[model samples]
Target chain A: MLKIDCKDKHFSEIGKTIRESKDKEIVIDNCLGHRYIASGVGGKDIVINGTPGNALGSYLDGCKIVVNGSAQDAVGDTMNDGIIIIHGNSGDATGYAMRGGKIFIKGDAGYRAGIHMKAYKDKFPVLVIGGKAGSFLGEYQAGGIILVLGVNTDSKTNVGYFTGNGMHGGKIILRSDELPDLPPQIISRKANAEDLQEIEKYVQEYCSYFGGEPKDIMEKSFYVLTADSANPYKQLYTSL
Target chain B: MAINYIYPVYEVVRNASRCVNCKICEKQCANGVHKFDAKNGIMIADESKCVNCHRCVATCPTRALKIVKSDNTYRENANWSAESMKEIYKQAESGGVLLSSMGNPQPLPVYWDKIVINAAQVTNPSVDPLREPMETTVFLGSKPDEIVRDKDGKIVDNMTSQLKLSTPIMFSAMSYGSISYNAHASLAKAAEKLGIFYNTGEGGLHEDFYRYGKNTIVQVASGRFGVYKDYLEAGACIEIKVGQGAKPGIGGHLPGTKIVGDISKTRMIPVGSDAISPAPHHDIYSIEDLRQLVYSLKEATGYKKPIAVKVGAVHNVSAVASGIARSGADIIVIDGFRGGTGATPTRIRDNVGIPIELALASVDKRLRDEGIRGNVSLVVGGSIRNSADVIKAIALGADACYIATAALMAMGCHLCRSCHLGKCNWGIATQVPELVQRLDPEEGCDRLVNLVNAWTHEIKEMMGGMGINSIEALKGNRLMLRGVGLNEKELEILGIKHAGE
Candidate 1:
């Protein structure tokens, strides 16, 4: 793999170097606060060692990104197709507007994860967060699948407040009791046998990436949140 | 229904002698304004459904059809006009905020008409553009605040990236979802042919138009729809849409009805889903935050494409512009209230932002005062009407101008102002397969090219009349402009003298 030390380089310079490289697989080391790494880049397997900044793997198309450490906000934003494996926690708006991708985060995530995730044609994005998730999870999501495992959290709640607010499509699988006091527009349900089957492949992939027993994880009570189609936010616009 | 409360605003008059019994008008109207009367063996009209798009009038074979605004009148109460009463009645009928397409039509002072162009006299001989070379070419992007040189004492060309336009006018951002694929294709093809650029609004670039990358400016808005790495790299320049002029603070809303087929793929959203963009980029809470997003785009594009920060002409727009100038934006596009849109709430569209003339003047002056004018090129647009308006805008310190409604008109739009209904009989805005097919991209492109080509030549003529062959000399040449029917306050804001002075 072609390796580069992005310790003190500006993000643009580093990005330029990465784009100019003909190597199919690349490794970036010592990534600090430099943001927008691998933005709109595709067709490569990028491995990052240190903590990458915000918008990591943003707009990443048809690539594989392996982040060894925690990442900041907007990971895999509007990503079309890719596999981003993050071993550590992530910041807010993770997987924002993601359309097609598999974002496997081992640790907890900040607010607004999978916000506006959608799918069209054969493209469906699947985001799996290992630990607990913050509030407004999957807000305004139109399609795709989001799974928050809530693995090893000391907190009482698995997912935070206002989860699935303005959510129109897609399914959010939370590994806990159904969230309470959400917008009346959401339809949260206990994942039954058929529901588990629907998410079986995604669960298998997440378990493989983050080291978990599939049966043990699936055994836990899971809840799915989908927007109520009958009330598709007519109030969003002013009435008269 | 109870009182025949509303009357049709327009009436179609057809002459029997000149009119052939052809069903072309019935076939052309998407609004169902014309129908063939089977028993009578003649064409009948449903004037209430007519939007006055003139499609039927234009399609009449023998020039037999004509449309006129009906003398439809309410009681002569200046306070409650006909349109206002109709609007209230419509709202009462259907409890929905009235949505309008195109620019504000509230008789808000059109500064373009108020401003007058100055011509050269005996002292400065005017050149004939027909025979003489009048340079209309311009480059829109950040220039170095100060040129730096090495010990060799040679000046360095360290300017940021710039978009070189053969003409100073470019087709503004009109997304794929808002306009038809044919409209976008026409614009792209025309931009390519004209050596200018067309914007792929907030809607993502259609995959077919990727070949026009050299002439496309892809836009990233709060929704971040269709923004991918490839999209970021697809355009010659990237525009970050902070605010749109038509709905200043509000975000774009493409009703789910219009989101179908390739539009779904282009925008990466589901079919028949409302694509509502947030008003603000959640990541950018401040100018410092704006800087991060700006630099992020630059990084994503390898600092190759110029980054433009587009904002509406709000009260403190110039202040915001100064912040954008410092935020590493290569270009700042200030859109005034009169800017067009696919759909916007009528209230907001009519009354929200400042005029383009004042905003452009203020931004230009502010940038020049801060000595950061060279740091970003200023492109102003909102109802840029003709060559005179363009010349006026350039004199007020705009590097270039953007025109949308004019381009739409050239593409067979009749400005029926009912684009929100998506039944564009002229086939400019609607997405219905039949209506879309009506606008053949090949024909549309030629018309657009002809329009811009005509405008470019006219701009040259105006520049020649001013005894200024090069557009660069006319940059911020406010002395070449004079106000006619404007107040002192307007004159001060425009930074120009009275017509006689």
Candidate 2:
């Protein structure tokens, strides 16, 4: 393991150092809001301490990023394959356009968490937020699974208004009996045993990282939200 | 149905004297316009279904068929034209937004026609392009701000990555789902042969065309479809599509029906899922946010490939372009309102954006005024009709010109203006198997090469006439352009003088 002190280092210097380093396992300490840390870097395990800035693991291909402190916006932006474990909360668009990855945030996430998330053949992106999420949580989500556990929230819903607006595919599982005000295009239903069974792996993994009881979290009432139709604009236009 | 208010816009004129009863027209039309009546031993036409694409007229063995616009009159109302009334009737019946294809076909003023190129007459000797060396190759990207010298007293080469084009013309963005596979193949092949880049639009690059990675500009729109690690690094440059010229503020929704097989696989979405690219990149709200996305892409590609930001030419395009120049973008592409699309709302397509000529002039002037023109390169598109337009764009401060509608015409599009119907007999826009096979990629590529080669010759002639031997000398040389019958405000905005002056 190669430990490096990121004190008073420029973002580009930090990036170039990590890219040129031969070390397989690297640790970054004293990080202070340095954006794009470990961006598009794969084939290694990176552990970051202190607050990491926006786009923490953007385009991260087959790497593991462990953040000891909170992360800013666009944490896993357009990431193809990776595992990001954030011990604290994350800002807006935490998993924006992530195609294939697992982003586990111990605390809450800001707005547009899983916006435009999609899935390919064997790559299914999973984003699990321990606490509540902001508005437009799954806006325009095409595929992938988003789980909001509402770990310490007293609110009635785990997500905010306009959740799953224009969503065409994938599932948004929330640990709450009452649902938020959703757009007309989305359809929500109570998660049955099968639905819960499907997310068991993600839930167990989330608990193991954040120190929670997976059984207790899985036994709670949950609701699933999905788009009514993949073809939302079939009747929206008249050919001329 | 309430007396059938709509009427056929075209009339099929089949010459009875030249008719051989070959049934060729009936076999060529994809809109089912021509029907063979075996008992009657003749061909009947459904004028209502005729898009007037000229496919049958061009394919007829003999000169036996022609389509003419019907002289249908509706009281000759100047305020409400026939097209406007028909559009009203269509909306009343379907209750949906009107969709159109191709560029804006309105009788708007084309600035390219108003501007004239200046040639050396008396003082400066005109060099013949055939005799003298005329360079048309252009490099698009930011040049180094200042030269740095090393301790060894050697000048360090600080030039960033650039896209080198043999000519100032390039094929514009046209996605695979919106067009056919053969069309993409033709464009990829033609781009390779011409040493110019062809854009993948927002549809993502097909696996087959990946071989042309050196000449491909992979696009990353709001949807980010088919955008993964490999896709981002596959192209020579990456374009972040903010808005399209056809529909400035609206998002693009490729209907689920068009998503199938290769398109689905290439875009990495489900077979029937609608590929929706929202108006705004949700993550990008400000110029600072745009810088983040730009840097993120740079990081993804290891700062090897240049990043371009494309936006529609609107009322305040100069300001928007200025902001983009400062946002770390290597290139700024401004698409005019007359740009073509497979589908767009008719009203938005016709009324949303400004002309390319005016937009290019103003953006170039503004960037130069800010003293940051070297920070990024400018590539303008919307409707580059010919080589003259390309020359005018370069003189108006554009680094290069992107052509889509003209490129499609070179590939055998008849401008039927019915690409939204997905029954294009020319095989340029449709996705059906039989219809797609009609456009042979080899023939299409050859034609495209011929078109660009022809345009390059004309460009060289125009440059030689202006006493310029290279595209670099022609860049932002507005003094060589003169406006005819243009008002003071128009001339001022275009940064050109009157023809007499």
Residues forming the 10-long window of minimal summed lDDT in candidate 2 chain A: A10-19
Which CAPRI category fits model 2? high
Candidate 2 TM-score on chain B = 0.99
Q: Taking the tens digit of each residue's C-alpha lDDT, what string does model 1 give over B242-338?
A: 9878989987667786788999889988788878686777667799878877877887777788999999999999999999999999999999999
The true-versus-predicted C-alpha distance at residue A74 of model 1, in Å, is 1.5
Per-residue error for B11 in candidate 1, Å, reads 1.9
TM-score of 1: 0.95
Candidate 2: residue pairs that collide: none
DockQ of each: 0.41, 0.80
lDDT per residue for candidate 2 within A1-240, as digits (tens), equals 878788999777788778888998999999999988888888879999999988889889988999999999999998889899999999999889889989999999999999989888898999999999999998899899999998888878988888998888888999986989988988889987799888787889998898978888887799988889888888999878
Model 1 - which docking category?
Answer: acceptable
lDDT of 1: 0.87
Error of 1 at A141 (Å): 0.9
Badly placed stretches (over 4 Å) of model 1 are A198-200, A230-240, B1-4, B150-157
Error of 1 at A78 (Å): 1.7
